[model samples]
Target: MNLAGLIFVLVTHFLAGRGVMAMFGIKENKRKTLALSMIIGVVLFHFLPVVLEVCHIAITATSISIAIGILTLALFLPVSYKLDYSVLKITRPSFTLYEALFATLLILMVIPSVWLCYYFPVFARDVLSGPEPLAEYAVREHTLINSALSVDLTSTNNHLKPPFILGLQVIYKLLVHPFGELWLSIMVCSFLLMFYTLIRERVHALIVLFIMMLFIMMPEIYGYMYIVLSDYPNMVLFFLAFYYLGKYLETKQANTFYFATFLFCLASSIRSETVVLIGLIVPLLLFSFIKDRIKPGVIALRLGILLVIPYLLYYVWMNVFVANYMHIQFNTGEQLSVTSDSVNIFFDRIGIILGPMLFSEHARELFGYIFNIFLFTLALDLVLWRKKIGLQARVMLYGIVVVLVGLPLLGAIIPWFDINNTTKRGVFKLFPLAAFYMANSPTLLQLSQAIKRFEFPELTAQKNAAPVMAQQQKIKKKK
Candidate 1:
């Protein structure tokens, strides 16, 4: 591993992302904005290589470094606009003993995950054949359209998938590590921090820690944290996209909505199938706009923005790049199941996905009790707080449905989309949403408030007395 190169790449991304957040006016607290900056930087930098390739520039170390320098300077050009250092001024919150323990446990898990990512060679078959070799050769040859494309890849279409993974791999392999997957670790850590920031504000610190523990403990999801695959990265971007979308719903902030759309575009760039899922989200966005009583023209325009961007990305990759640039005859129609029993096949796939694949003993081994906890929390909410369930929670539930149904729909349309491999990993998209919903659980929120009251009784008493004192003062004034 090129330790110095890794540090340089990470720092450049952090600073570049920080500059972007500042330029766009996407304000959060210092910590959260920092986390979001890192994530946004990772996704945005993917396009640097794409731009180079479009211009027929070789993806060499010097080229990439120069590009980074140019982008960084461009972002930080406004020297007079002071960067946000308010995080330094804010006092840190005191953690209780239990919160400290939970933090320690999460740190322990993260350390080993990073180590494993650094230690292991590229091993996933999908990656081994596709992005891994392509990236390895692209680094060696300094061109993406290299000798790797000349080989016979009749067995798998993985090579024809979007260049998002290839772009990251090329950058990382050149600048970070030989395996080029430390980007995954960067992504994982940034996402976890941002997630913590989001949830800690709404739930008790202790409960937030517990939720983070459950998230890190999921066997399938945890393994992917280190493993180099597109699914986990896709899940991270997709989840963040919706998180921002929820923020848009709450604040009606254009920047927030555009950020969500940008993340969704990044997610789509990772997997072509993501376009379908984005389509599923359109109705939700449209309904929200209607309820807000926004003009039909503006509503249509915003919905168009959400849907068009992803489709344009999809077309660039699948239609333009793959067909013209690579000269590959990649056909989606050939992958579809057109048999008379296609409907039955779709329903069967759905049943398998929601049934044994979700709840069976084997699934318990793969996912542990995470799904069970989500279902239980969801049922509890439905029974006790169904009417009280807020739009954000409902939006999460809507995402859960979109993924669950969208996967089977994809399987039905694309013959090779199997329940075991593709569908299994596709289910990763749901876990983060589940975690978000769990964070918003009303019972959990109430419990979080009770815990806070118990932990700081004096503060609670002060709060309780203030209202009473005000009432007594009013009576005295009336007399």
Candidate 2:
């Protein structure tokens, strides 16, 4: 049954992704289109069913399946008619021996990580205190409702969470009756695949594979693989949002914007804290408008569709449905204060969070090797390929800084929050973006070039000489 559920999830997500890409007119790169589609599909899977249930529609397996079928056919038919399939064909990338070895090592790492997800227990305190119980309750009710009548297995705060993951769990439970470790396994593995797929599209296969290995090997990530936590899923969604945003900046493509907007909406739905992504995005969008000299009306319309509407919808859903219906306090006032002492405390808390990541032995044991490699490579990339860094890499770097630094500062200032416990988990949301940029550093390209030069110096020399020789020959012919 679990196997069937997994297969079902895979097929559903693929068709859904295909439909989304077709709707958005995204046909630039098949892999990217597929990745974006899967993300959209998953978000829709969780969102559509719950919204239907909320509107008093019966959400049976047949109804859900039929809706998906109609959606796929509706979007796909028109796009298929217009698409030039030959343009979608991507030639397979070749790799050197060193690249092959790195890819193999990463693949090996993925196997054990997937095994760990199945073997481990869902013991994270957050899981027990939050989404898991809510999921169980939703499954039992056969509909989603945030009311006092619901089972009180989890905290009031948990009930107030955006219902994306909980809704997903309900679907999983309904499909696979005895949902145990399989749901988590599916989530973790899907996350791994998404990260790999996105990275592979952007970077070389060898670099992407190495990045995946490092990401899965993170002690915090490995520890939480089986746990039903929002942190990892939030990270994946946020990274995808930023990644597509970066692509939009580079290519000025409408489809990338659509995909990025979809991802940002999905990310925002997972946790209230993910609303911080909006803080990052708004400034970038403004900058793009100015830089591109885009018309004001067009800018406003794009921003409205991408940022304003989605956030407004989430705001209403959370405040009206989740908070009011569940009788959960939407206590913004209690969480922040602007006194001098509070400002000092915030700085102190930032120090506390940074201390472990910067100096602690356990942190060293866990992240030291990867940290050093990333730092060294990043520095090299900046020095060697400053002009080539591109908007995406820069945005991702800024995001990491914001997560590592800004989040801790926010934790410190927030009067009611627990910095010690939440800071670590909060930082987990930045790992996917950090790992990707680290792997894509020009250092990898330089290293690959050096290896090629060492093995086949003549070929390397000829490649370099050809460009200069062509220019020289052209000059001579003109003279």
Candidates' TM-scores?
0.95, 0.84
Error of 2 at 120 (Å): 6.0
Q: List the residue pairs that clash in candidate 2.
A: 17-37
lDDT (0-100) at residue 431 of candidate 2?
A: 69
Instruction: Report how far residue 186 has shifted in candidate 1, in Å.
Output: 0.3
- List runs of model 1 lying over 4 Å from the truth: 76-82, 88-93
Q: Model 1, range 1-479, lDDT digits (tens) per residue?
A: 88888887887788788777766577788668778878877877777877788889999988988887788778766732686565668686887787688778879989998999899887898988888888888898888788887889998888888877788888888888888888889899999988887888889888888888888888899999998888998999899888888888888988888878878988998887999999999888878888889999988788888899888987888788778877887777676777788788779988998899989999999988888999998899889888878778887888899998899888887878888898999999998999999999887887888999999999999999999999999999999
Q: Rate the local accuracy (lDDT) of all candidates.
A: 0.85, 0.66
**Model 2 accuracy (lDDT, Cα):** 0.66
Off by over 4 Å in 2: 2-5, 28-31, 58-60, 66-80, 83-104, 116-121, 146-156, 180-210, 323-338, 365-368, 381-388, 468-479
Estimate the TM-score for candidate 1: 0.95
